[model samples]
Target chain A: MMDRRRGLGRYGLSLLRFWSVSLAAQMEYQLNLIIEVVASIATLAGGLFTLSLFYAHGQRLGGWSWEEALVVLGLSTFLDGFSSTLLRPNLGELVKQVQNGSLDFVLLKPIDSQFWVSLRNWSPWGMPEMALGFGLVLVGLVRSGARPGPGGVLAALLLWACGVAILYSLWFILAATSIWFVKVWNATEVLRSLVGVGRYPISAYPPALRLLFTAVVPIAFLTNVPAEALLGRTTPFWCAASAGLALVALICSRLLWRMALRHYTSASS
Target chain B: MNHQRSPAPEPTTRPLQRIPMRRSPLRIARTLLVSQYALMVEFRAEIVLWALSGVMPLLMYAVWSGAPAGAAAGVNPQQFARYFLAALVARQFTVVWVIYAFEEDNLLGRLSPLLLQPLPLAWRYWAAHLAEQATRLPLVAAMVLLFVAAVPAAAPPLDPMRLLLALLALHLGFCLNFLMQYAITMLCFWNERVSALERLQAIPQLFLSGLLAPLELFPEPLRAVALHTPFPAIIYLPAQLAAGGPIAIGPAFLNLFGWLALLLPLNLLLWRAGVRRYAALGA
Candidate 1:
């Protein structure tokens, strides 16, 4: 147990070091960072405005109160920021690497290829988006006046971790497909569009779609469960289901990555 | 002796004749159409992925349906679905990637050679737009038919004449959006971050163009303001027409053409200025 803990601690420190270097490099482009932050803020405001408009027209959406809906939006925005900043800059590179056969360098590294690829780059400019999302979550919590118990907070934390795992697995699956079909970048975009539905409450969709998002794609597990936990509406069963789904996704993506690596051919060939 | 030499020299060569067989704009357009069509076929998978990205409308449809019945003021679930379905099809035609394309071309110095060509740059952009839309038509049609067949209530009332008119409006909408985007993209010649401007513009386009919701659902003053702008001519008007909603076809077409006419001169002016600003660096 002590050895395992030390190993995990070393990995965490390395990731922290990678992020610091990446952040410093990104800070060199100060003007671009400022512009991106400003643009992201504007987009956030626009999204909030659209949400308010819906509330103005309808008192509730998908049985969700306005504050609850805001919570879901906040969670979605936070996850989106996390993915774009970390997973996107790195895993998104997998496509180009596969196309150019530069992925051989990644595979040759002593570190885990998936771990290295996922932590290779970071966009500090996206930090503002995460900040704004956290702000929204606070606003929603304050407005809703929902105070979660200790267990609820713990459950929310666990579910949030599961959301992250599921996202990483999904992204890995997308990147893995490029090994077979070199031109699958657009497929990733389609996946983004599909996952984007999580910005709204799952109940907002039709019955059939709700099932698909919940079970097939499991997008509802990403944001809804976290938000619901914060609202003290999460059931133990739902929490377990989310964790189970994340485990399944992780195993499936691991298998896919191994299979795909076998098909990879260096550009020299 | 000099006069005899000059006469012999004059007899040695025939005068050259110039042929006036320059390609008409029509012929150039045709050639561009065919070439772009072939290119689009090569990128058919990408085009399909692009079409599949139009899920926002479907999401809104779900939200509208889930909203309390008659929750969207006066718009019912069926009307909402019909409107969004129409918007989806219209969007496949009106979507423009000029900003990104221009940014890349300008940054990479590819626009220099294109400028040397006798044909105007707009023709190339137009051909690309036409090709993408043409390639996307079948997919859009399949999606629409599937939705309508599955959810019969989502089907919009259609008369042959009205459908024809709506198609015309949709085409004009595409032109209006393309012109506006082309004009916006000209900023890349002077600015490296035209994407910021595009995102800023998207705020208004989303709110005013009825992408988020129907314009009628907007509060009275906002609705009036949105109607006055050219944004509605892009997606909302065509959607309204497709849904067989109350719309003045004549006035709508006039609104669309007016926007197009205004944008044409602005586009030309910007293009000239942008070309002048293009340093022709690395050429």
Candidate 2:
């Protein structure tokens, strides 16, 4: 037990060091911070404008009220920001490491390769978007008159955690494929574009696409399910299913990474 | 022969300044197209992934078709599908990556070598974009056929004249987009990271360019304002024309030319200033 505790403590300390170094390096470009803030604001405003178009003329998309849909949009925006902060920086580095055989040094380290590779980089540019997304969610809850109790809030947080796990697993899985297809850099772009559809409630899509997003991509869990939880409208079944899917996805990503390493002959070998 | 003789006579203590032979514009264009196309074909796999990333409009169609707004706006599901499919094609053809390319080359100091060539650097990027569009054609055609096969009712009857006109609008739209982005790319001479500015430009392009939903669905004031911007001329007008939707051809062409007239001079000015600035910075 003491050994396990030390291991956990070491990982925590390593994460802190990793993020601080990257933050310092990134802070050299002060203008980038302002650009990121403005770009995120513009993006959120444009998203709100598009969302408002659906609600114009007294229409609800797939039976989702305006405020309810706002929650989904907020969640989507938050996930996008999260991706920009964590998933993109680390996974992009992973692809580079694979191309140049720097991953060999990573494997030689005393820590878990997956954990080190996945959590080694963080960008502060996504902070404003994340805050704005949380603000929107609160506004949506107040406007929609859905006051979640303590238990409801806990459930919502848990489901959101599940959503983040699933999202990370999905990205890591795709990034792992770079080990085989070294030039599959743009594959992540395709995934990002597909995830853009999650801005609306799953029901807003046609039945066919609804099924595809839910089953094939699990985008429904990424935004809709968590939004439903926030609104105090989620069922126990969905909560359980979301947790299950998140677990399955996380496991799959781990297994795939392990399998991919076996195939990694190192660059120019 | 006159040029050769003059150059031979100038062989003195100083090195001769050879005046390049005047080549036909057509020949120059053909050579640029062929060489760039060959380069593009080598990266066909990455190009295919890039083509698939343009599935935004198609996804929007799936939502809009089922939404009540389509019915309220007097556009049925079939029209939504047709419009978005055409939008997908329009966006595929008009996509510009000049800013990304230019920023990279400028920062890596590759632009100095490119500028040393006799050809204007803009034509190289333009030829590359045209070649990429050519590479994308077969893949986009396959996607369209698959969509039409899945939903036959979404297929509109092809009008020969409108088709020709839509082709013209599409190419003009590509030129306008290229110029606008190339203009933005010139800022790389001053800023190391101009892609952030390009991201800002893309926000308006996304909301206003009829990529998310048809511009017809936007409220009156917004739609009118959007039409005035250069965004709609890039996607909305050409897509609407190709989809057989009602649009005034003359006014649409006028809009394209108007923007072209404004941007062409702006690009030329920026190019001259940027190159001078670049030289100073490099020195």
Candidate of highest TM-score? 2
Candidate 1 C-alpha error for residue B206, in Å: 2.8
TM-score of predicted chain A against the true chain A, for each candidate: 0.93, 0.97
Candidate 1 residue A175 C-alpha distance from true site, Å: 1.9
- DockQ score for model 2: 0.77
The models' CA-based lDDT, in order, is: 0.82, 0.90
**Fnat, one value per model:** 0.58, 0.79
- lDDT value for model 2: 0.90
Clashing residue pairs found in predicted model 1: none
- Candidate 1: C-alpha lDDT: 0.82
Q: Candidate 1, residues A1-269: lDDT per residue as tens digits?
A: 23344557768876888889988997877887777677678767767766776687557887889998899889888887887798788888988898887888989965678778878888876788888888888899889999998998899989989998998899889888888878888887887878778888898788999999998888999899889998999999999999999999999998898888777777666
* Docking quality tier of model 2: medium
Question: Which window of ten consecutive residues has the lowest lDDT sum in model 2 chain A?
Answer: A1-10
Off by over 4 Å in 2: A1-5, B1-20
Per-residue lDDT tens digits for candidate 2, residues B105-211, read: 87788889999988889999999999999999999999999999988866865888777877888899999989989888988888878888898888899889889
**What local lDDT does model 2 show for residue A49?**
91
